[model samples]
Target: MQKPYLEISHVNKTFQRGSMLTDVLRDISLTVQKGEYISLIGHSGCGKSTLLNIVAGLTPVTSGAVTLENSHVERPGPDRAVVFQNHSLLPWLTVYENVKLAVDKVWARESASVRKDRIMRALEMVQIAHAMDKRPGEISGGMKQRVGIARALSMEPKILLLDEPFGALDALTRAHLQDQVMQIHHALKNTVIMITHDVDEAVLLSDRVVMLTNGPAATIGEILKVDLPFPRRRLELVTQPSYIKAREAVLKFLYERNKFVEAA
Candidate 1:
């Protein structure tokens, strides 16, 4: 069997909050093929975001391991790029500078022209080139988020991690950004793992949807393969049985089976 490009092996994470130890994730293992899109969906406390953070090397696992392309992931590096739920832009910087900062760091050895090209391409990819001169405060929420994505992409990481990126947006804005993300993934084929609570968003974007059981110690409960064909249209999918079936499977797992667990 071909080895997966990204591997999470028997991972567990625990935190010492005050006097007590809290188990956040337990024995979580997953394999992601290159260029595939995977979505993690569960109730609020399921540790889905925690798992994504571990993969991004933003957080360390307490036990077990995570690897990408056979290299062990120990800390945050250019190989993995993350876009958090909040835009997290440096308020003092313009969109161009925000993305340029990443490109400069990753391609430090390269010439200035090459770095400029990388920044421009990333901004264009997210359709934010027009707002390149605008600071974070000057743009709308959706546009700021797009700049965040562009900054992440400017690094040309092997995998992209999105942590509920559109969660704060209105329904219409969320839907539009979801479509933008799908198109970007379709074009770039970057391996992705996203944490989301939206069932429709998961089904519409992922090649596979990974469902997690509730927390204190969350683990993978079910994995649903989205068998629908690509170049997927939102209008057409609403009426497609395969799409509906996939969407319902995720909803069932979230609502009927694995209910939310209150935090400790």
Candidate 2:
């Protein structure tokens, strides 16, 4: 078998709170293949976001290791780009500038024209080329998230990490952006790992859904393979029997895990 594109081996994370140590993640292990779309879902505070941060090297792991293509991950690099829950765009800069910042940072040695071309291409890919001149404050939440997606993709990362990237948007807007994201993934075929609480969203986008148990120290509760074919249609697929079955499996895992945590 080919080596996994991204691997997390027996990872754990703990935080210090005053005089006490709070364990957040415990013995988490997962392997994601190239071009795979994986979603992590669980109750609030289940360390799903923490795990994404660990993958991005935005947060340090207390134990174990995260590896990409056989090398250990110790710091952030252009090879892995993250889209945060909040669209972390610069309000002072135009949407084009916001994306340009990332492209320039990662490819600073390239000529100016090359950098500009790359940024514009990413914006076009996200269908936000029309909003290139607008600031984040001037765009809708969904549009800002698109800018975030554009910035991340502009880096041409090996893996894309998204932490609840549409969690803050309204229902219709979130649905629309979810479709846009799925379309982008289909076209680009980049490896993607997203942390989301939306079961329907997970079913519509992922190749597999991994659930984490509730945490003071969270761990993987279950992994459900999504048998639905892609390029997936959000509305049509959501109503299919396979999609319903997959969503149920994920929901049951999260519900049962939360109950287990509550009783402990």
Candidate 3:
């Protein structure tokens, strides 16, 4: 059998504040194939982002481990790039500059021309090259998110980690960006691990939707395979029985099985 491309081996995470200990994740194990698109879906506090963070090496695990391409993931490296919901751009820099900052960090030793190409290519990949001269504050929210994605793509990371990257956008813009991302995935065929609360988005984008049970001990509750062939279109999927099946599976897990209630 082939070795897994990305492996999360029985991982666990905990938080310590004063004398209190909270377990956020327990015995969470997953394996992702290279170039596959995956979405982590669960209700709030279910540790979806926490698990993504562990794979990104942004947070340390309490036990078990993560490995990429058979290599231990001990820290954040160029091979793993992250794009968060906030867009996290430097307000002081142009869109081009924001992406350039990341290219410079990962390819500092490369020739100036090579680094410049990477920045341009990445910005072009997200169709935001025209706004390369604009500052984050000067661009619309959707454009800012585009720049954030471009910055992540600049590193040519083995896996792109997205933490609710479109959660802040309006519905129209969200749908538009989702289309572009689908194009990007088809073009790049790069591995993506995204955290999203939107079931439609997951069913539309993912090869598999991994659902987690409710926290503070969130573990994989179910994995739904999206059998619909891709180059997927949103409107077309709406009436697809396969798409409907996948969407209902996710909804059932999130609403009926793992329904969330507020803490008093």
Candidate 4:
């Protein structure tokens, strides 16, 4: 049998502070196929971001393992790129420069022309090429977020990790960016794992939505497969039976079983 593209086996995470050991994730195991879009949905304390961090190799897993292409993931590398809720663009850099920084770091051995192409390609992918010369402070929140995504994609990472990338935006802006991200994923076929609390967003964007139980030691509660076809339309999905079923499944998991608590 062929091995999974990304294998997360029996993973657990814990934190130590002032002699106190707090268990975060417990024996979580997941298999991600190539080009799949996975969403992690759960209550505030359920460690969705923590799991994403572990997968990104930004945080250590206390036990078990995460492997990509049969190789163990032990540290942060170019293979996995992350986009956070807050755009992490450098204050001194323009949108172009922000993406260029990542390309330079990851593809340092390439020629200057190659790096520039990489930067421009990513900016254009996110539809931020028009604002490439603008600084983050000079743009709207949505544009800044697009730059953050462009920087992450410029590295040509094998997997994209998004942690609430649109959470800070207004409803309309959030919807627009969600469409952009979905379209990008459809085109690039990049493997993605996003952390989101929105049931509608999860069903809208994911191939499978993995729900987490309430924490101090959270584990996967359910995995709802969204069998909807590609190029999903948000307005049409509202009345579509398949979309509504998936959304209700997530809602039932989040509220009826998991009892979601909003983080302060």
Candidate 2, 23-118: lDDT as tens digits: 999999999999999999888887988899899988999999999988889898889999998999889999999999999899999999999999
Ten-residue region with minimum lDDT total, candidate 2: 255-264
**For residues 1-264, could you state the per-residue lDDT of candidate 4 as single tens digits?**
766899999999999999999999999999999999999988886799999999899999999999998889999999999999998889899999999889999999999999999999998988999998888889999999999999998888999999999988999999999999999999999999999878889999999999989998999999999999999999988999999899889888877886655532
Candidate 1 residue-wise lDDT, 1-264, digit = tens = 989999999999998888999999999999999999999988886698889989988889999999999999999999999999998999999999999989989999999999999999999988999999999999999999999999998988899999989988888878888888899998889999998888888899999999999888989999999998877889999999999899888877876786534311
Between candidates 1 and 3, the one scoring higher on lDDT is 3
Candidate 3's residue-wise lDDT over 1-264, tens digit each? Answer: 877899999999999999999999999999999999999988887798889888899999999999999999989899999999888999999999999999999999999999999999999888999989999989999999999999999999999999999999999999999999999999989999999989999889999999999889889999998998879989888999988989988988887887645311
TM-score of every candidate:
0.96, 0.96, 0.97, 0.97
State each model's C-alpha RMSD to the native.
2.0, 2.4, 1.9, 1.3
* Model 1 stretches with alpha carbons more than 4 Å out: 260-264
Error of 2 at 212 (Å): 0.3
Worst 10 residues of 1 by lDDT: 255-264
lDDT of 1 at 246: 90
Q: Give the TM-score of candidate 2.
A: 0.96
Residue 143 in model 4: shift from native, Å? 0.7
